[model samples]
Target: MFLAWNEITRSKLRYALIISVMFLISYLVFFLTGLAYGLAQDNRTAVDKWQADGIVLSDESNTNINMSMIPLKSLDDVTAKEKAALGQTAAVIQLDKKGAEKVNASFFGINKDEFLMPDIVEGRAFDTDDETVVNNSLKEENGFKLGDTIKLAGNEKKLKIVGFTENAKFNVAPVLYVSINTFQEIRFEKVDTTENARINAVVVRAKEGAMKNVDLAGNDLKSYGIQTFINKLPGYNAQVLTFGFMIGFLIVIAAIVIGIFIYVLTMQKATIFGIMKAQGISGKYISISVIVQTFVLAVLGISLGLLGTVGTSFVLPTAVPFQSNWLFFLAIGGAMLVIAVLGALFSVRTIVKIDPLKAIG
Candidate 1:
């Protein structure tokens, strides 16, 4: 350890450059990982909060909640620990009647009494058809406030912001919670009293031991567990896969880079290793020192990288979906360290083959 550290202190600029490379690479990996996690959570945060065991949708809807249309009477045929009817549609809402600023939002028509209704972080839940609760992001990012009236761009339906809920988003859009009746009027332009009145799907909380039985093929509906539904969210799988590959490749590249640098440094000090061996110093000692040096460099580089990432996250605006998960950072950092150690092992061969007489001459 002393030999490794002493050499580093002696050649401060050389080691600093190598450490800088690791730091930048690690920082990029960590930042991308945060983005990937944030985007995935944005797609399903509201649904995850439901803690529902399963969701029932028409098979004809191709597993899409927005496309599914099941008759309200179908709820009677379903059995579970608890079930709630859900209606969903996408909309662009204007902050004012003049249509100056607009935001994309998902409208979720739910009964205030149902488990699907999220607890309000501020204000109160909607009590009337004209009142709606929105995700707290609206207040932070769009300057929405309690009692602000929101105007639906195309249908001219105006909704009052009654409350704000945290972590309520779907498909990267904020969710608007309104009564089922209001949703029907917005979706169909008129409420129907016929026997065929329909809703998007039924969300269920099944008994602990009955998840496997949640599917209802006989009732012409299909069931999906909360995780399965999340995986099926539009573009969710694709985004996750893309980020996974990128992160994986970056780690591999980091390993190779560390290996090359350490190997080059070891080759430069070959004559020094030979002279030490000629003086009766063991090859194992020199080999161990090389590994120790690599370890020290890796730790310093990764630590600085993580610090940079944290600093960047703090300055980022709320509008940017950046979430910090220490667990992920630690895992990635640990992987980089391990691979760096393994990378240093390649230099052991050079140390082992050093001939004392040739190096001294």
Candidate 2:
């Protein structure tokens, strides 16, 4: 430890430059991961908030909310402790306020009186067909306020914003929570509440594994775990996989670059290594010193990267979709440490091969 520490202290400027590069790479990977996660979340954050076990859809719907159509009575087929009959559609809202304009949003038809309702961040849940709740993002994205009247596209209905919520989004758009009847009216342009009423799907409260048994063959129904169903959302899974692969490749490249860096440094110190061996230092000790130095450099790089991420968050524009997940960061850091160690292996091998008799001859 002393040898490694002393070497790093003596060549502080050289090590600092390498650490700076690592910091920038780490920050890039982390920030991009957050952005990818945020985009994926925007597709299903509303559903995630339900905390439901699974979803039951008509076989023909192919796991898509907008494509599914189930009879209202299908809700009764779900043998669960709790559930909600939900519906959704894409619609545009025209904000008449000075600083606001028309924005595309998703309309989610949910029972406010039921457990499926989202956590209200401000104000209260909607109690009538004329009232609606909006996602928290809309407050900033569209300059919305409580009691502001929003005109629904393709319909004459004007709903007053009653509340705001977090994690309420669908298909990459913010959600507008309304009564099931209001949703039916907006989606189907009807007032019928029962007798041949159709809904997209039924959210169930049983364990995810148990949802498959919730078959309503009489209605030609199928079910899937919450996460399983989310993956089927349009373009959601594909986007996640694409970003994951890209980030993974970048990390691998960093490993190769680290290997090259250590290889060059070790070659330059070949004579020094031979002299140390001639002075009675064991190869294993030298290897340990190299490992310690590599670890120190890795830690410094990762720490600076984390700090850079935090700093970037403050000045980042609100429109940029990005959210930090601790688990992802931890995973990245662990992978980096492992790679850094592996990168130093070439140097260790070179050190072990140095001949004591060749020095000072």
Candidate 3:
């Protein structure tokens, strides 16, 4: 340890450059993870925020939320079987903010007093059919002010934006919460009968053995657990799989590069190590020093990488979905450290095998 510390301290600039490499790669890993997580949240934040166990939908819809339409008659049976409520009508919001200005959004038609309704971060929750609560991103994207009246571009239905909620989105777009009354009106275009207000799905709360089975009106409707439902969200799997592969590749590539770098450095010091072994200084001693050096480099690098990520967060705007999950960061950092340590081990055999005669020459 002392020998390793002595050399590293003596050649600060050389090790600093090496440490910088580790730092940059680690920062990329962490940043990409955050970006991937943010994109996923954009797809399902609204659904995730709902404290429901499962989602009920029409089986014939083939897991497509937009295609699924549950009949109102099944509501009583579903409610009796488990706690439940209605929500549907995902749409693009084309309010008349300016000529031809439109915001991509998920328009959720939900009961005013249900778990699906997220708490208001600004203004107040929707109370009547005429009011709608939107995600915070809308304030910037469309210049939406609280209590401002805007009309849906294609539907011609005017409603007031009364509140803004945080972390509510669907399919990478902002979420707009409205009354089931308004949902039916916008979706159907006519307010003739209750049957016209058919919804896409029921957000339900249930546990194993919680209720008796309830039929979803013929063979067209069924329910799924929350995680299964989330996995089926559009682009959710592809995005996650792609990013996961990127992160995995980075860690592995970094390990090989770092291991090779450390091994080359060890080979260059063959003469010194050879002399030390010849003088009974022990290959084990020098090998231990090399391990110590690798450990120091990893710790210093990961620390700086984490600090850099946190600083980047401050400079980014709220419009960017960069969520700082400390646990995730720690896990990534830990993996980097482990890979680095394993990389360091590749030099041990080289150190032990140094030829004293060749080194002396």
Candidate 4:
């Protein structure tokens, strides 16, 4: 063990090269994992915040919330089932500010009275019909503040920014909250300059056991051209599964690369190992030394890789959609360590097979 450590310390250039390779590979794995997680969260953050048991869309539109429209009359029909209420009105609004870039923002029209608006960071929630809340991410990017008026969709309607909230993005765009009336106006436009269009979907919250039965009411909304309840929002499950697969592939690749590198390094030192065996040094000692060296390298590489990932995350813009959960980090770290140790063990077989007589010749 002492000799192995001394050899590593003396061959600074060689060890440094190996560590650098490990570092690069590990960093790539972590960065890919972070990016995959970030994208999945970005794709579903808005729907996840709804905390609704189910969503109702138009049958003709399939599961697409954007294309689905439910009349205001349907709200009562859905709420009659149980604890359900009209969820937030949602839309995609394109904003064009004078002398500034055109930005696409998610418009969520929530009943301010329902306490469904995202937690406020600055200012207050809407107090009037024309008031709206913008995400802090939007506020910072556009330099807007409370009481500021912003033009939407070719300056057709100017909406007031009443408040700023955190983590209220939808469909990868920052969210802005307004009254349902406003959202309807923005969405359908006034037909004949008087009547507003219907809403896109009715977000329903069900009473306990409502999901168990799988029927909202005796009306059979699905048969009536209204799409029945979807327990989870569309696109959510698929997005998560895709990201999980990507992260899993990256970790596996890292393990294989590290394992192969360590195994080859150990093989190269077979002659030296045999000489040590001839000097009465046990194979067990050589194997332990190799395993310890692998562990040290794995730890160093993963630690540095994590540091790099965190540093990169800090500079990443919120728009980039990067999320990091601690459990993922720990899981990846543990897996890397274990795989590296296994690779070291593969090389240890050569130590046991070393012929002491061959070393003297």
Model 4, 1-361: lDDT tens per residue?
Answer: 5766787899888777777877887788788778777776665565556665566556675566666666655555554233222323344343434576566777776566653556778988888756788878776676677887777654376678888887766656777777777776666554222332465665555556254433444342432122232213456567767867876776677667767777787777777877888888999988888888888878888888888888999998756767887788888888877877786787788778878778556
Best by TM-score: 1
For candidate 3, lDDT tens digit of each residue in 38-150? 88888888887887777788878767788887765556546423545565665656555566466677788877766778889999988888899999888876677887776
Q: Which stretches of candidate 1 lie over 4 Å from their true place?
A: 215-217
Q: Return the clash pairs for model 4, or none.
A: none
Clashing residue pairs, candidate 1?
none
Off by over 4 Å in 3: 79-82, 94-100, 208-218
For residues 172-282, what per-residue lDDT tens digits would candidate 2 score against the true structure?
A: 899999998888888888867676887788888874547754545464777778988999999998999999998898788777776677678777878888899888999
- TM agreement with the true structure for every prediction: 0.97, 0.94, 0.93, 0.84
List the candidate numbers ranked by lDDT, top first.
1, 2, 3, 4
Best by lDDT: 1
Q: Estimate candidate 4's alpha-carbon lDDT, on a 0 to 1 scale.
A: 0.67
Cα error of candidate 3 at position 300, Å: 1.1
Decoy 2 TM-score against native: 0.94
Clashes of each: 0, 0, 1, 0
- The weakest ten consecutive residues by lDDT in model 3 span 209-218
Local distance difference test, each candidate: 0.90, 0.84, 0.80, 0.67
What are the RMSD figures for all models against the true structure?
A: 1.4, 1.9, 2.1, 4.0
